[model samples]
Target: MAQTKQTRGACAFCGRQMTGNGMVKHLSACPKRKDTLGESNPKSGKEEKIYHLKIQDAWLNDFWLHLEIRSSATLKDLDSYLRSIWLECCGHLSQFSTKGHLGEEIAMDSEVSALFHPGLELTHIYDFGDSSETLIKVVGEREGTPLNEHPIYLMARNELPEVETCACGKPGAWLCMDCTESEDEVALLCEKHAKDEQHQDHNLMPIINSPRTGRCGYAGPADPPY
Candidate 1:
């Protein structure tokens, strides 16, 4: 592409004298392009230039459901567009405001903070260990098969993800049965071992002295009857 000349003009913003070539690139990243670039006639019909943005994450859609929108739109416009977001979800998220943290309020008419200003960046939600900051994970599916996989979990990206603790780092709970309860879950002795007739204590009783010791039965008192 041919570069244009800077015929003595300052950047619409920041007051930098942008060269013609620099102006092209600058417009690409500029936040004010929506307002600065447009049709001339007052109220004449114009096809608004639409730009496409990627869906950053699956979970962050709590506020932005549509993956793409027009540059001419402001963050506040999106804030107003999110009415359905509040109705679908529950909890304190039932509402939103601009005064508190971005996550505290949903896009609603009630609060100023709920409004997204122009050029506001939408970060993938994350947890930052504090009174606030809840982590939002994005599990992803295998390429080409979004339906087959889960959200790509950005674990501990913003804060340590809330993970259930395992007692031995095994599949069990953080506190094993021994730690949580003083008493063990009671169960009767193996019926087959306890009922063995040949066993000394077989009479359907727990045989502490048996060689198998209530295990699979042995010769005379094989196992009691299961």
Candidate 2:
């Protein structure tokens, strides 16, 4: 397999950019996050188990996210979040299942507390046709007050992967769906060639920071939860 370029993303807590594994380590000991946790006002509810999950595009390793979610949240909550941030297009059906357990579909209502544990992995499939698959791993868990009232907290994400431009070799900002269908042609294009005679009539999609980019009707990511 060919190696993809390593990309770095900013920490949601401190805005410091780091590579995937580096972000994982940084999140575990992020001082800003620790301080925020310590400074939160005590609430009436008992502390709950907050799970740390690592989600990544199954085939595109460069697109990934680290999230902190309360065990009280349901699989449906995760599904919704994933759709909003990465996969929603045409209101398609999606499902979660044990990563290697064939045909074992996890219920959407299943609570995180019931389904997750350190090292456990699940696969999320969106849209039966032109599907986008994501691998979710239970990185670890901690007992703590729920961070805000949201079901999940964005912790870290991978920066957009770098892609080569068209045959012209200029910076690419658009993808031509028509050319994409032809095995011999390059689909990526710069602003100039994207409007050139050959590609002007082609179905063009903006090159955005998403695994679903250039697939189905995905335009770009929705706004971040934070």
Candidate 3:
């Protein structure tokens, strides 16, 4: 597969930017994170078992996320979050399974604590027909006060992957579905070319930060949970 340019994203807590691998190490020892954990806010909830999860597009290494979720949260909660942030275009069926898409199906109501462990990995498949698969791994766990009222907290995520420009040597921000379907060549286009007389007849999809980009009605990600 073709590789995307190296990308960096900001830490939700301190706004410090780092590469994906670098963010993993940084999150574990970030001073701001430590400080947040140390704060004794009266509004904080009781201690709970929180699991650190690493979620990544199964095919694209460039699209990924690090999350801390309360073990009490159900698989449904995780699924809902995934939909809101990345996959919900049409209300398509989704499932969490053991091996891959054909693996043992896990119930949506199952709690995180019931299924997750230090090294457990699961596959989440959305839109069975034009599916987007994500690999979810239990990176680590800790007993601590819940970060907020939400069942999960976003720690970090990958910045958008960079794409090659159009034939005109300008940035490509649109994709021509006709070209993609034909598989003759990449359909990336700059705004100018997207509206050009020769290209305007083809169906166009905007470039977005998602593995689902140009696929089955996916427009883009919803506002992230920070």
User: Candidate 1's residue-wise lDDT over 1-226, tens digit each?
Assistant: 0112212234443445444334444545555533433322333223333332222222221111112233344434333322122111121122222333454444323322332233343332222221111121112111121110111111111111122223223322111211222223212323342333533332232222112111222112321111
Report the C-alpha lDDT of model 3 over 1-226, residue by residue, as the tens digit.
1356767888988999988767777888899998988873546577878998888888887888889998889999999999888888899999999988889999999998888889899999999898899999887788888788888889988877878788899988998888774533667999998998988688888877777787788887655644
lDDT of each: 0.26, 0.83, 0.84
lDDT value, residue 198 of candidate 3? 84
TM-score to true structure, per model = 0.21, 0.90, 0.92
Alpha-carbon RMSD, each predicted model: 24.3, 2.4, 2.0
- When summed lDDT is taken over every stretch of 10 residues in candidate 3, the lowest stretch is 178-187
Candidate 3 vs. true structure, TM-score: 0.92
**lDDT at 149, model 2:** 74
TM-score of candidate 2 on Cα atoms, chains taken together: 0.90
Clashes of each: 24, 0, 0
Top candidate, metric TM-score: 3
lDDT head-to-head 1 vs 3, winner: 3
Q: Residue 85, candidate 1: how far off, in angstroms?
A: 5.3
- Stretches of candidate 2 above 4 Å error? 1-3, 41-46, 182-185
Candidate with more favorable, higher lDDT: 1 or 2 = 2
